[model samples]
Each structure stands twice: as structure tokens, then as C-alpha cells.
Target: MPPEDRSTPRARRPLRHLRAAWPVVVTFIRSWGLMALLVAGGLAIAYRFVAPPPPATLRIATGPGEDSAYSVAVARYAEALRGQGFAVELVASEGSVRNLELLRDRRVDFALVQGGVAEAGRGAGLVSLGSVFFEPAWVFLRRDAGIGRLPDARGRRVAIGPEGSGTRVLALALLEANAVPADAIIASPLAGAAAAAALLAGEVDAAVFVSATPGQGIGTLMRAPDRAMLVDFEERAGAYATLLPALTPVRLPRSGFSLPEDLPAEDIVMLAPAAALLAQADVHPQLVSLFIRILQAAHRGRQVFAPEGRFPSALNQDVPLHPDAARWYERGPTFLQSWLPFWVAVTVERLWVLIIPLVTLGLPLIRFAPPIYTWQMESRVLRYYDDLRRIEEEAAAARDRAARDAVEAKLKALDTKVATLGIPSGYGALLYALRRDIAFVRDAVRTLRRG
Candidate 1:
């Protein structure tokens, strides 16, 4: 307690400020206490919508190999993700059936799956990011076989692709729907370039290539010119769609598969299923949203079979859209894409869900805030002064000792009440000043008794 230290401006200033600031501080503390649980619970609920960081690398099951468009599309996705600091590992599989199996088992992070290969048993465990491309069932035949349509190929050697491909699943389903007896057709396991080679070598009567348009097999068969002809679905495209809900009818121009040479002399109608990007149910939403943006960039624009921006479509059966994708289809990309960089946009978008509600509450809370503070400072503590004035007035009018004694008792009780009051640490200066004022009133009563 040095005299110079006590008199220092800094020391006195804080003490004076503390006394002035207590009511504001206490008012805030009380207000915050009332809202603490609500804010905490609301934030906890908002946290559920926050997506986790995308993985450093992702493993996706693509079809057959690099020659296949499914595989090529997956490779493009890998390249795009790589530029964004994420590595996408492409795993070659038999085809759509195998992709579905891998996704069901959670063996891979993502897959290039053919539509309609997914079975109900594992349907709940997976979701589609949207169809990225079309896998058209291209049936190329030897001109001499006289195969004008699907039924004509019966009893002819047909290579629909090997065991588990989406090609095989779709080919068989279409044949069964067309009422082509299974016993009449000789189905071969050869697929891809092998199937195309078989038909060219005269080893098979017809080869069915279920591939993304402009397949290597189709290009190879195009070299045959007049010898190989595309079967026409003609007006039967809608019939096929009506018969099989999963198949979408599409028309390809004479040279849709290859531009320079008119592969087919005229337009031919065909059925195809979209090749979708599918993932396990637990896949991170950030990665789902990230992949869709990248894939849309990769799949958008006109292709041989589909119109520009026709793919990455949410319209498919057998599977639901991934939640992120449903939002994507409804909202048309994350809102942050317009102004911010990719990474920053994703982070902000993830937090934006929480920010909305907090902002909504904060505006009204701040707008109506003055009354609460005024009551804390001007009314609560100041009411003690009014009580003291009433007691002084009663004591002055006292005609007998009993009334004066009652006023003294009330003052002693009031002093006791002030002494025992509990308050926060920051309010200590105000509490100290209040006690000093109470002491002054007690001294005045003491002097009245002596007089």
C-alpha cells in the first residue's frame, strides 16, 4: 500500500471503471446464462450438417480396362480430382455388376456403375451421384446372317459380354422382354475388342457390345463397312423403355459413333442405360459434392448418343440420389462455386448451413437489447436508495420510541441483507461502494438516536 502506487492513474482508473461496468457485466452474464443451453444445442444440431474433409485419395472401380469408356471416364475423374489435390485410384473390374458388388461391400470409395445392375439387397447401402454417361447395347452382325432385328439373331452366335457386365444384364433383359427364346440364341462370353474380333473373324454370327458410344469395338467393326450393319430399333425405342423401365431409348446418327466416316448409312434407334457414379452410403458429402463438380465438367457437353448436359442426370430408378447430389440437382451446384476458389468454397459452404440460423437469431436479439440493460443499471440497484428514503421518512415522523425502534430494526436487517449478497468478481467494486453507502445510512440513524 505505498502512497505513490495507490495514487497512480492506471491503478485508480481500472478500479473506477470496474465500479461503472458491473451492471453491464452482470446483465450480460445473466442473459448469456439463459441462452447458453439453447445456443449449445442448436450448434450441436447444426454440426450434423457439416461435411467431413474429403479423403486424400479415393479408390473407384471402373470397367474392364482403359480401352472401355467407363474406364476412360473414371480416368478423367481421377485426373480432375488430382488437380484438386485429391488422388483417385481407378480399379478395373468386370463391369457394372462387379462395380455394384464392390460398392455394396464397401471395398471401394466410388464406382462407375451401369444403371439397373444394382440389386435390392445392397441398394440401401449405396447411392448414385448421377448418371455420367450412356452404355449403349450395340449389336453388330455379319451381313450374311440376315439379322434384321433382335428376334432374327436367335440361334445365331451372340457375344453379349462376359459373366458379370452391365452389357450382359441388359442384353438378356431386353431379349427376354422381346420374347426371343433363350434356347434359340447361342450366347458367348467374349466381350470388348475380343467380341468385335470374333464377329470380324466369322467365329461368331453376331456380337453385342454394351459400351459408351464410339466404343473401340464399334470403330473396329465400322472398318467392315457393308459387312457389319447396326440393328434398327426404329420406333420400338419407346416400347423398350415402357417394357423395361431402366432402359432409355436414344437415337444415334449415321456417324454418331465416329464423325469422319458415316459408320451407319442412316440413323438407328437404340436402347442404353446411363453409367452412374455410385458410392457407399457412408462416403463423405464433401467428396460426393467434389466428385459431381468434377464429373459434370468431364461429362457435360454433347456426346455421340446424348444431348449436351444430358448426363449426370438424377432421373433413375433402383437407387436414390446421394443426399449431396439431391441438393446439387435441386440447387444446381454449391452456391460457393461462383465467387470463391474450389477449396475455400467447399469449406465456406460446409459452414454456411450453421451461419444462417445464428444470424437470424442475432439480429432480433441485438435490436431489442437496450431495455434489458437499462433495467439492470437504472432500476434494480437504484431501488435500494428508494427503500432507504422511505425508512428515513418514517423515522422522522415517529412520535414515540416504539416507532423509532422499529425503523432502527429495519435498517439493521437491510444492512445485513446487503452484506450477505453474492455477486460476480467483476461486480466487486460496485458491491463495495454499495456497502459504504449502507454504512453511511446506519451512521445517520445512530446520530438520530443520540440526538
Candidate 2:
């Protein structure tokens, strides 16, 4: 090389040392290697800090057509979710049982299911977002039929609603409480306006209607003044539970059914149950939390069906609260109704935040940590070189068997130390080779002493 272009030997001295020690540098890099990997992981986790996607399109399962309170509830939920940028689809269902079945099958994302119908095998994958409403049991009888409690209508024709409905389940329980034989009663499985029509037209002497309090059809009937009589269930509550364990005893205040004149003075004994929202166990925690906030918002102030704020409480339902819902309760009441958009954002981003530190600091360290640790471990074995030199000098001038044996034992002990140090799983062969080299040197020293 030309003198002008060439680096002087003195100047290149640092380069030569660096080149010689490149392997040592690489070894150090391998040790504590986890630090670099952990930093990278941390960066990857941090990259997930973007804003969440817009509110999703959801499907809510509601009862019947547009006439039922189930349908009315759907409208209310849709309106609220829409304000939060969610597009909610309302699927028409037969009633609570069908709503719960849809939720179990993943056919709909949400539903309003009455409490009593879900007894034995029906409630595996469901979760209550919270109670949306209480479905009051309204049993109307013909004026002259004189049916006070449920048992009096055993021989008479009755409409309890179609199959797989909350009304049918409750009606069966009411009759069983009265000791009315299932075969003795003429049970008609009709629903909504059809059940009402059957009772008014005298095709059925009594009809059981399960709907929100002051329900439209029952409200219309109550307006007719003495045309039909409401069954008073106050006296027979314990008897009611003995027959149907799931039936909750409640009261419809005198003003609930009365418009122009008070019907009954004090609290009247009535039977009712809450409708719950349920979902699969594996449903995403964020979605579960989001749905709860929306539900609480939809029914914030006054109760649409039961007493104000009483419908959504935890004590009202037959099923246990979803874990996600339980967590929200732990954090105190939800404020999403007042600051919806903010809370929605908060809910979605919370999970990502929790995972951030682990990815950034924990995971990267896990990946890079092993190689770095191996290098440090290898250095401990490498330390035998200095001790071996010192022993070789002492063995050359050994005067007796005792001195020779002492030097040999020291070398043997060092060999064992090197042998016992654990190596990585993939480096087992390398460790064996290192131990074999140490043994070969020790054997060479022993042969020299014999000579």
C-alpha cells in the first residue's frame, strides 16, 4: 500500500488488539444478551399504543316483533350504543329462553333473559351483564270465574304462552303450587295479544301474561275497569317457593295497576324475576366490560319496568355475575354514562397497557438472557488455565511421592470443578470436549513425574 494511504504500525496496534479480542467481545455480548432482547420487546409492546378501533357493530337479541317490551329494550340499547358509534342489530326472539339460547349459540352478542326459566341445564355459558328489567307475572281471570290464587283455575281453560317462554315456565309453577294436576288443567300455549284475546273471548277463563310492569296489553286490560280481576299472590309466597324455588316474591304497589282509582291499598304480594344478559365464558374481557357500561347507561335513572335503578342490581338475578362485571363492581360504580366516549376508550386500551411492561422488559430479557449467561459460565471454566501453569512448574521439581501426590490431587480437584459446572442444553458436547482437554493435560503432567 502507498505510504499516504497506509496506517502506521503504531496507529494500527489498537486494531490488532481489537481483532485478537473480537471473540472475547462476542462472548461478553452473548452474556447479558437478554438486556438487548428485552429492550426490543419493550419497543414492540410500546408500538401497540395506538388508539382503539371505532365502536363495533353489535347484534342484540330481543323478544317477538316490535310490540314486546323486549323489543322496546332493544330500541333503547340501540340508541345508546349508536351514540357511542356502535351499530346494534336487534334480532327478534320468542322470549327469554330463546334469547338465552341465542347467546349460548353465539347467534347474538347480547340478550335480555328472564331469571326463572334458566334452571338446570340451560345456563352453562351465560353471563349477566346486569339486570335490564323485572318481568312481573300478571294473571288475569274472567270476572265471574272467581279465581283468587292460581289453584282455583285447575279445571278451567288457561293460556300460559307458547313453549320455551318465561310466561309458560312461571304459569306451570303457579299451577303446581295450587296442587293443580298438569293433566286436569286445560293449558293453552298462546302469547302476547293472542293470549289476551283468548281470555276476553271466553276461549280461556284465565291467562298468564309475563311482561314489563304496566305492560301494554295488560295495561289496556287494567283500563277496562272490573272486566278482569288481578290474582293476589301476597298470602301464598312461601307456598310459591316450595313449589318453584326460582320464583321471586315481589309486590306491585296499588298505584302500579291503578289509573283512575287505587286497586289495592298496601303492597300487594306478587311474583316476578329479573331478565339477565349472558354470554360465553371465554368472551373477551374488554367486550364484557364494554357491554356492562352500555347496559348501566341504558337504564341509568328511573326503571323502565321495575322500580327505578332496582332492575340492574346484582342481587336480583339467578345466575352469578360475570367475572368481568364483578371486576367493574370492585372499582366502584361505572361513570361511562356521564363520559361515555372517554370510558369506552379507557376500557379498550386498558388491556394493552397491562401487557406493555411484560413485552418490553420481561419477554425480550427472556429471549436474550441465555446466550449472555452461557458466556459468563464459560469464563469460569476458562479460569483453570492459570492454575494449571502453576501446578506444572511445581511438579517439575517435586522431590518425593508425597509432594507429587499433593500436586496431582490439586490438579484433580480443579478438573472436577470444571467438570461439574453446568452448561446449556445445546452446548453439552462443547462442555465434554473442555473437560477432556483438562484431563489430557493432567495425564501428561503425571507421566513427566514418572519419568
Candidate 3:
């Protein structure tokens, strides 16, 4: 140790360093660390209540044949939804009656149901987006059937449509209203092209069709006007509409089918029921909104019976309107929906409920947490004053120099501990005051020693 190796670095004092850092670690854990835990807990609770993302896949029930209006319209809907990142599977059923059954059983998420098919008790757990289009009742008769009116079909061969069809439902209701009992007519369970072919071949005296758009069956009947004629419900159209609240009186104008042919030759007044887009009540609100938007794009154009923008309408719905669809109909799309991508807009709308509470609660915490942290830090330093007061009392009561030296030694230790405290810069004034109080105690002890 001759020259003490003058240039050598001193050994590190790890214990003193730990002592200085300990208070800061404790203060942070007691203040900011606890605050962080509180915030994390709040977020966890909020996340539990957050709405989950909508399903990526959707299933819809349409009519039996691909050529039918229900099937064709739903196919277009599937295409549009697929463009927006959805996987759509179409389930073909008999008609509106079967579609309603599929929707109620949860076998399908959505269905195109004719308005009058959903009876009072059968529509539970279902809601309507809106009425998409009108489906008119077309009663086509063989030219020699001698059936002038609905009641004239009594005791005659009639194709009233197959079971689980909207046409059959309307047919039975009209026949019943006209006092034609089910057993009174030879009722053939024929529909679509089968019904059309039966009437053309004279196998059935009459065929009832409830369709929106002209398809193979309707087109065949319209072309063969000489063999088959669409009956005009002119006299009883209003009466039928009144009997069935869902039925609306509509007219198929002359040449409505073919402008060159002057088809119909006269306005054909018919009783029509709207085809409503029905959904399960539990369907996601975002999906409902998306469907409404899709329907708006698809049905806003003018059609044979409806004026432009008259469809996809809140009116003519058989079931209660879905809350989300009602909002969309009332206010149109939200600003976020108008600008952002579909999923992005949905995500923001879903999270908005969570974000609001967090902001409201976090703002006040943010405003006050720092002050609380400072108080905690300063309190740590202030706690030493109790020991300082105790040492001062012992110094004043000292009877001899031995006692006085012991008290002074304790005072020096306390001063060294205070010097090593790791208070933040902002709290330096409180630390300095504590040190000054210790100094005053030391000065009093020294005066006692001298006396």
C-alpha cells in the first residue's frame, strides 16, 4: 500500500446506493404503481362489456327455385355482401312460409318473407329490416275455365300453389273470403313453372301466383295471354286489402311486361303484399346496419309497382322493425359509416361506449395523480422528524458527557441518513427543511454540552 496506488478508483458503495434508491422505489410503488394497477383493472372490467365483432359468415333463406325473384334478389345481396368481406350461404326453401320457419328455427340468419305469411304468434324472436318489394297475387285462368271472379272458381280445378308458399297462403285466404271452402275446389299443390304448365295444358282450371319480378313461370303465362288470362281484382282489390292489413292494392299497367306487345291490354288491379327482409332478433346490430345499406342500394330504383326510393321502406313491414334498422331508416348512415370502411366504422362505433367512460374517469385521475405522488414522496422524508424529535429530547436530558456523546453520535447518524435520502428534485425544499430541523436539534444539543 506504499503510495495507495494514487490513480486507482475507489471501491463501489453498493449498500449506500441501495439505501438512497429504496425510498424512490417504495414511493413509486405506493403511488404510480398503485395507480397503474387501478387503471388496468378498470380497463379489464370495461372490456368485458364491450360488444364483440360481428360474425364473418351469414346464411340466408330464399325461395325454392334459382329463377324466382327471392332467389335472384338474395343472390345479388350475397354478391354485394361478399364484396364487403362476408361469406354468404343461400338456403333455398319452398317460399315465404318456409323462410319464416327457417328464420325462427335459427337455421338461417336472414330470410325474404312475404308480408302476410307471418301470423300473430309465429313471428317471435324475429325482426324486419324493411319491406324490399311488392309481391302481387296473379290468378291466371285457362281461357275456357268460365271463372270470372274468385268465387266463380268454386267447384273448379285450381292450382293454389304448393304447401309452405306465400301464394298458397294468399290463395286460401282469398278463396275463404269469397266463401269457397278448401274442399269445394279440386286444389292442386302446384307452384312456379309446374303451376304455369298445368294451367296451359288444361290440367288445372286456374293457377295462383304471388311473385314480385317476372320469372320463367310469370313470363310463360304473360306470353301465352290467348290461352291463359291474368284475372283483374279490380272490384274486390280494395276489399281484399282491407280484409288483410298486409295486402296493398297495386296495378300492373298495360304493356307493363313488354312495351312492344301492349301486354295486359288494360290496367290489372291486384292485391299485393310486400316482401320483407326478416332477421333473427339476436343478429348483430352492425350486420343489421350493413344489410340496411345493401337494401338501400338494391331497392331504391323505380319498379313496376313502386316509385323510385319508395321501397326498402319502413312501411309495409309485417314484423317489428329492428332497432338498428329503425335508426338507419330514421337518420340514414352515421358519419363514421359514410366515410370509413365497413368493419372500421363498426369497430369504432362498438368501442365508443367503452372509450367514453375511460375518458371521463381518467381525466380527473390524470389531473390529480401527480399531486398525490408528490405528497407521498414528501411524506416519506417528513416521517424522519419523529426520530429527530426523540433524539433532541434525549440530548436535552443528558446528565453527563458520556450520555451527551451518545446522543450526538445518534444525531450524526441521522444526519448521514437524511443526506442520503433520494427525494425527487421537486421535493428538495421539504428535504432541505427536514435537514434544517435536524441542524437546529444538533445546535441545541451542542449548547447543552457547553453549558
Best by TM-score: 3
User: Using lDDT as the measure, what is the rank order of every candidate, best first?
Assistant: 3, 1, 2
Q: In model 2, which runs have C-alpha deviations exceeding 4 angstroms? A: 1-38, 42-55, 261-267, 304-306, 333-451
Model 3: per-residue Cα lDDT over 41-81, one tens digit each: 77778888889999888999989788888998899899999
lDDT of 1 by residue, 2-46 (tens): 123455588687775576457567777676544555556676788
lDDT of 2 at 248: 71
Question: Candidate 1, TM-score vs. the true structure?
Answer: 0.69
TM-score of each: 0.69, 0.64, 0.87
Global lDDT scores for all candidate models:
0.75, 0.70, 0.87
Candidate 1: 10-residue stretch with minimal lDDT: 1-10
The count of residue-pair clashes in candidate 1 stands at: 1
Please rank every candidate by TM-score, starting with the best: 3, 1, 2
* Index of the highest-lDDT prediction: 3
Report model 3's TM-score to 2 decimal places: 0.87
Q: Which ten residues in a row have the lowest lDDT in candidate 3?
A: 1-10
